[model samples]
Target: MNIEWSALGSVIIWGILIGAGLPALFALGVKTLAVPAGPDGERHPSLGRRVGAWTCFGVIILAIVGAVAFIASGGH
Candidate 1:
């Protein structure tokens, strides 16, 4: 049987991105949120770091939801 190389390649790329990339993104989000407070005495981090962490988490959540929806609808 002949293999469709293009389809295989596409699957490989998407798999890597979704599998490794998503987890790595999640780790980065955790790391971003874990940074120490300001030198003097700030308990919370700056708004930008908080936003970045949330944005990364949001993207991952969206990706998960999208995958579920796609599967539910019989994804292509």
Candidate 2:
């Protein structure tokens, strides 16, 4: 069969975005959640940390959506 470049491009782009974006987002989140110790030597996640975690969770949701779409697209 003849090769299809546009389909290949779509698959490649989606794979790259999903593969790289998710991990980068998660790492950024983990870094933010890592709170430095105060004089009490206790670390706590601030509101920003919670929000970042939620944002990463949202990214995970988006990734799952993308996966569903990709599979439905029949890329394989």
Report the alpha-carbon TM-score of model 2 versus the true structure: 0.67
Q: Each prediction's Cα lDDT score? A: 0.89, 0.85
**Which residue pairs show backbone clashes in model 1?**
none
Error of 2 at 55 (Å): 1.4
Clashes of each: 0, 0
After superposition, the stretches of candidate 1 with alpha carbons farther than 4 Å from their true spots are: 37-43
lDDT, candidate 2, 1-76, per-residue tens: 9899999999899878878878888888888888897788887889988898889978888878887998999974
Candidate 1 lands at a TM-score of: 0.79
